[model samples]
Target: MATYIIGDIHGCYDELQSLLTQAQFNQNTDELWFTGDLITRGPKSLETLRFIKGLGDTAKIVLGNHDLHLLSINEGIFPNHKKDNLTPIFEAPDCNTLLTWLRFQPLMRRHPAFKFALVHAGVYPRWSLKKAEKLAKEIEVQLQSENYKQLLIDMYGGAPCSWSNNLTGIKRMRFIINAFTRMRYCLPDGSLDFKNKLSPEQTNNANLTPWYEAITLKPNRSILFGHWASLMGKVNKSNIYGLDTGCVWGNSLTMLRWEDKKYFSVPSTIK
Candidate 1:
C-alpha cells in the first residue's frame, strides 16, 4: 500500500481524479495525504469536499488558509469573495458537515513510518518540533470547542510577528495559525515577512528567505507542505518538499509516493 501525498487541490476535482487514476490509488488500501487548500479557485469545490470527506480513515489532511476562510465565512466573520469559488460548497446540503470536518483537522501532522511532518505551510524558524506541535494543539483545542467562532474571529492578521514563549491568548494563536497556514518568505531575524509572493529567484530582497531555508530540521525529519503555488514544486533544499504545482491556475497537480519517492502529476483539465 503506497502512501500518496497530494498537493494543493483547490477544488480541481477532475484533475484530482485523473491524478488518482495515474497513481493507481486504491481507496481500500492506499493512503492519501492532502497538503490542503482542498477548496476554492477551481471548478468543483463541493465534489472535492464530499469525495475527500467520504474517504474517512484513508485520507489525511492539514487545513490550509482557504479552508479556515471558509469556516470564517460560515460564521459570518468574512464575506464570500467571488474569486474564492466557494459558493458551491455553501450551496451544498452537507456544507456544515464538510466545514466541521475541516475545522477539526489539525494544523500539523507527523507520519512516524514515513518520517514526514505535514503542514499546509512551513514551520516557524524559531519553533522546535515539540513546541510547534504543542502550539498547533493549543489552537486545535480552541477551534474544536464551543468558543471556536471567537477563536476564528480573532485568528486573523499578522501580529506578534516574532515567536515568544511568553505570548498569550489570541496573539499566540494567531501566530501559530500564520506559521502553519500563511507563511512563505521570512525575514533574516526569523520573523514572518508576509509580503513577497515571488519565487526565491525572483525576489529582489536578499534578506528574505523561504521559511524552509531559514531553519535546519532535525536529521531524518522531512517536511511536506503546500500552499506556495508560485514555487511550482521546485525547492532545492534536502528533505523539504513543496508539492503545490498551481493546479488551480491551470497548471498540473503533483503528488509524491513516499515509499519509493516517485512523483506523479496530472495536468489540470479545468479552464
Candidate 2:
C-alpha cells in the first residue's frame, strides 16, 4: 500500500478528485496524508470536508491556519470575511461533526520509518524534534478539550516572535500555533517574520530568511510542509518539500508519493 501526501487543498474538491484519479488512489489500500488548509477560498468547502472526514483511518492531516480560523469563527472569536468561501461549510448539516474532527487533528505528525515529519508550515527554529512534538501535543490537548473556545479566542495575532522555553499560557500556545501553521520567513536571529510572503529568492528584506534556511534539523530528518504557495513546490534544500501549488488560486494541486519520492499534479478545475 502506497502513501501519498497532498498539498493545501483549500476546498478544491474537483481538483482533489482529479489528483487522486491521476494517482490512481486506492482508498481501500493506499493512505492519504493532507498538508491541510482543507477548507476555504475554493468552491467546494463542504464537499471537501465531508469527503476527507469520510476517509477515516485512510487519511492523516496536520491543521493549517485556515483550518484554525474556521474553528475560531465557529466559536465567534473571529469574523468571517465576505471574500472567504466558508459559508457552504458553515451551513452544512454535518458542520459540527466536521469541525470537531478538524479540531482533534494534530499540528504535526512524524513517520520514523519514512524519516520525515509533516506539518502545515515549518517548525520553530529553536525547537528540537522532541520539544516541538511535546509542545504540539500541549496545544492539541487544549484544542480537543472543552475549553477549546478559549484556545481559539487566544490563538490569533503575531507577537513574542522569538521562542523562549519560559513562555507560558496563551503566549506559548500562540507561538506554537504560528510556527506550525503560519510561519514563512524568519528574521536572522531565528524570530518569526510574519511580514514576508515572497519566495525566498524574491524577498527584498536583507534580514529575512525562509525559516528552513536559518535552522538545522536533525540529521537525515526531512520536513514536508505546505501553506507557502508562493514557493510553488520549490525549495533549494533536498530534504524540504513545499507541496502547496496554489490550487485554490487556480493553479495545480500537487501530491508527492513518499516511497519513490515522486510528484503528481492536476490543474485546478475552478475558473
Candidate 3:
C-alpha cells in the first residue's frame, strides 16, 4: 500500500486524473493526500470537488486559501470575483453536501505512523509541532461548529502579522488561517508577508524570506505543503516539500510518493 501527496489542484480535474494514472494510484490500496486549492480558477471546480469527495476514506485534504475563499463565497460571506470559475460548484445539485464536507475538513493533518505532517501552507516559525497541532485543532473546531458562518465572515484579511500569545477571538483565528493557507514570505522575525509572490531568488526585498527558510522546526519533524506555486516545488531543503507546480496556471500537476520519495507529474490541459 502506497501513499501519495499531491500539490494544489486548482480546478484542473483532467490533470489530476492524469497525474493519478501516472502515479499508478490504486484507489483500493493506496491513499491520496491533497494540499488543497481543490477548486477555483480553472474549468472543473465541481468535477474536482465531486471526484475527491467520492474518494471517501482514500483521500485526505488540508484546506488552502482558495478553498476557504470558495467556502466564503458559497456561504455568501464573500463575493465571487470576475476571474473566478466556481459557479459550477455553487450550481451543482450536491453543492450543499460538498461544501459541508469541505467545511469539516481540517487545516492540518499528521500521519499516525509517519514522521511528517501535512498542511496547506507552512507552519509558524515560532510554533512547535505540539503547539501547531493544538492551534490548528482550535480553528478546525470553530469551522465545524454552529458558529462557522460567523467564523467564515471574519476569516478574511492579513492582519496581526506576527503571532502573539495575547491575541484572542477572530484576530487569532484569522492569523492561524492565514499562516496555514495563504502565507508565503515572512520577515526575519516570523511576521508573515502577504504581498510577495516572487520566489526566494527573484524577490528584490532583502528583509523578506520564504516561510520555510525562517522555520525552526524540531528534529524528526517534516512538512508537506502547497500554497505558493511560485516556488515551483522548490524549497532547497530535504524536510520541507513544496508540491504546488501551478497546474491551473498551465504548469504541471506534481505529486510525491511518501514511502519511496518518487515524483510524478502531468502537464496541464489548460492553456
Candidate 4:
C-alpha cells in the first residue's frame, strides 16, 4: 500500500480530485497524509471538508492556520474576512462533525518507520523532533478542550518571538501556533518575520533564514511541510520536502509518494 503526502488543499476540491486521479490513489489500501489548510480561499470549502471527512481512517490531516481561523470564526472569536467565503461550510448540515474532526487533528506528526516529520508549516529549527511533538500536543490539548473557544479568542497577536521555558498561557500558545503554521522567514535570533512572504532571496533581509536553513536536522530524517507557496514546490535540502504549489493562487497542486519519492501534480483551475 502506498502512502501519499499531499500539500495544502486550501479548498480546491476539484484540483485535489484531479491530483488523486493522476496519482491513481487507491482508497482502500493507500493512505493520504495532508499537510493541512484544508479549507478557505478557494471556491469549494464545504465539498473539500466533506470529501476528506469521508476518507475516515484512510486520511491523516494536520491543522493549518486557515483551519484554525475557521474554528475561531465559527466560535465568534474572530471576524470572518470578506475574502474567506466560508459561509457554506458554516451552514452545512455536517458542520459540527467536520469541525469536531478538524479540532481534534494534531498539529505535528512523526512517522518513525519513515523517519519523517509532517507539519502544516515547519518546526522551529532549534526544536528536536520529540520537543516539537511535545510542544504541539500542548496546544492540541487546548484546541480539543471545552475552553477551546476561549483559547481561540486569545490566539491572535504576536510576541515572545523566541522560545522561552518560562512562557505560559496564550503567549506560549501563539508562539507554538505561529511556528507550526504561519512561519516562513525568521531572524537569526528567532524572531518571526511575519511580513516577509516573498521568496527567501527576494526579502532583502540578510539576518533572516528559512526555518529549514536555520539548523541542521538529522541527516537520516526528513521534514515534509506546506504553507509557503512562494517556494513554488521546492524541496530545498534533501531532508526537507515543501509541497505547497499555490493552488489557491492559480498554481498547481502537488503530492509526493513517500516510499518511492515520486511526485505528482495537477494544474489549477482557479485562474
Candidate 5:
C-alpha cells in the first residue's frame, strides 16, 4: 500500500485526477494525505469537495485557510473576501455537505510510523509537535460543538500576535487557527506577521523570518505543508516539505510519495 501526500488542491479537480493518474494511485491499496485548501479559487469546488469526501478513510485532510473561509461564509460568520471567486461552490446543491466535511477536518495530524507531521499551513516556531497536537484538538472540540458558529464568527483578526498561556475565549481560538491555517512569515520574537505574502527574499522587512526558519523544536522530525505557493515546489531542508505548487494559479499540482520520497506532478488546467 502506497501513501501519497498531495499539495493544496484549491478545487482544481481535473489536475488532481491527473496527478493521481501520474502517481498510479490505487484507491483500494493506497492512502492519500491532502495538505488542504480542498476548495475555492478554481472552477469546480463542488466536484473537488465531493471527490475527496467520497474517499472516506482512504484519505486524510487537514483544514486550510480557504476551507475555513468557506465554512465561515456558509455559517454567515465572515462575508466572502471581495477578491474571492467562490460562487460555484456557494451555489452548488451539495454545498452543505461540502462545508460539513470541511469543518470536520483537523488542523493538524502526526503519523509516528512515518515520523512526519501534516498540517495545512505550518506549525508555529514556538510550539513543539506535542503542543501543536494538543492545541489542534482544543479547536477541534469547539468546531464540533454547538458554539461552533459563534467561534467561527470570532475566528478572524491578527491580534494577540505572540502566544501567551493567559489568552482565553475567542482571542485564543483565533490565534490558534491563524497559526495553524494562515501562518507564513513571523517576527523574530515568534509573533505572526500576516501582512507579507511575498517570497522571503523579495521582502524588505528585516525583522521577519519564515516559520520554518524560526522553528526550534523536534529538529529530527519532518513537516509537510502547503499555503505558501510562492515557494513553488521547494523542500527547503531535508526535514521540511513545502508542497503548494500553485495549482490554483495555473501551475502544476504536486504529490510526494512518503515511503520512497518520490514526487509526481501534473500541470493544472487553470489559466
Candidate 6:
C-alpha cells in the first residue's frame, strides 16, 4: 500500500483530484496524508472538505492556520474575511459536523512506520520530536475540550517567541500553535519570527534562518511541512521537505508518494 503526503490544498478540489489521478491513487489501498490548510483562499472550500471527509479512514490531515481561522470565525471569535470567501462552508448542511472533525485533527503527525513526521508550518527549532509531539497534543486536547472557544481566543498572536518549560496557559498554547501552523523564519537563539514570510534566498537578513535550517533535530528525524507558499517546495535539505507549492495562488498543487519519493502535481484550474 502506498501513502501519499500532499501539500497545502487550500480548497483547490479540482487540482486535488487531478493530482490524485496523476499519482494513480487507489482509495481502497493508498492513504492520503495532508500537511493542512485544506480550505480557504481557494475556489472550492466546501467541496474540498466534503470530499476529504467522505474519504473517511483513507484521509488524514493536520490542522493549518486557515483551518483554525475558520473555527474562530465559526465561534464568533473573529469575522469572516471576504477574500477567504468561507460563507459557503457555514451554509453547508453538514457544516458543524465537518468543523467538529476538523478541530479534532492533530497539529503534528508522525508516520507510523516511516521515520518522517508532518506539521503544517514547522516544529520549533529547539524541540525534540517527542517534546514537539507532547506540546502539539496539549493544544489538540484543548481543541477537543468543551472550552475550545477559549483556546481559539487565546491562540492568536506571536508573542512569547522564546520557548521555556516554565511557559504556561495562553502563552504556551500560542507558542505551540504559531510554531506548528504560522511560523516561518527563526532567530539564532531559537526565537520565532512571525513577520518574515519571504523565502530564504530572497531574505537579506543574515541572522534570520529558516526553521528547518535552525533545527537541531537528529539526522533520523525527517519532517514534511506546508504553510509557506513562497518557498515553492524548496528547503534544499534532504530530511526536511517543503510541500506547499502555492497551488491556491495560481501555481500547481504538489504531492509526494512515500514509498518511492516520487512527486506528482496538477496546475490550478481556478481561472
Which stretches of candidate 2 lie above 4 Å from their native place?
none
Query: For candidate 6, what is the TM-score?
Result: 0.98
Model 2: per-residue lDDT, tens digit, 19-53? 99998999999999999899888988889999999
Write the residue-wise lDDT of candidate 1 on 1-271 in tens digits: 9999999999999999999998899998999999989998898898999999999999999999999988999999999998988888888888888889999999999998977889999888888777888889999999999999999899888997888889899998899999999999888777888877889988989989899988788788899999999999999987999999999998899999999999999998866
For candidate 4, the clash count comes to: 0
lDDT of all predictions: 0.91, 0.90, 0.90, 0.90, 0.87, 0.92
Q: Count clashing pairs, candidate 2.
A: 0
TM-score of each: 0.98, 0.97, 0.98, 0.97, 0.95, 0.98
As for lDDT, the candidate ahead, 1 or 6, is: 6
* Candidate 1, residue 108: how far the Cα is off, in Å: 0.3
Clashing pairs in 2: none
At residue 96, candidate 2 shows an lDDT of 94
lDDT of 1: 0.91
Q: Which 10 consecutive positions of candidate 1 have the poorest summed lDDT?
A: 188-197
lDDT of 6 by residue, 1-271 (tens): 9999999999899999999888889999989999999999898999999999999999989999999999999999998888996899999999999999999999999988887889999988888999999999999999999999999998998899999999999999999999999999988888988998899989999999999988876777799999999999999888898999999999889999988889998898765
Candidate 5: misplaced stretches above 4 Å? 80-85, 217-220
**Candidate 1, residue 258: lDDT:** 95
Highest lDDT against the true fold, candidate? 6
Name the Cα RMSD for model 6: 0.9
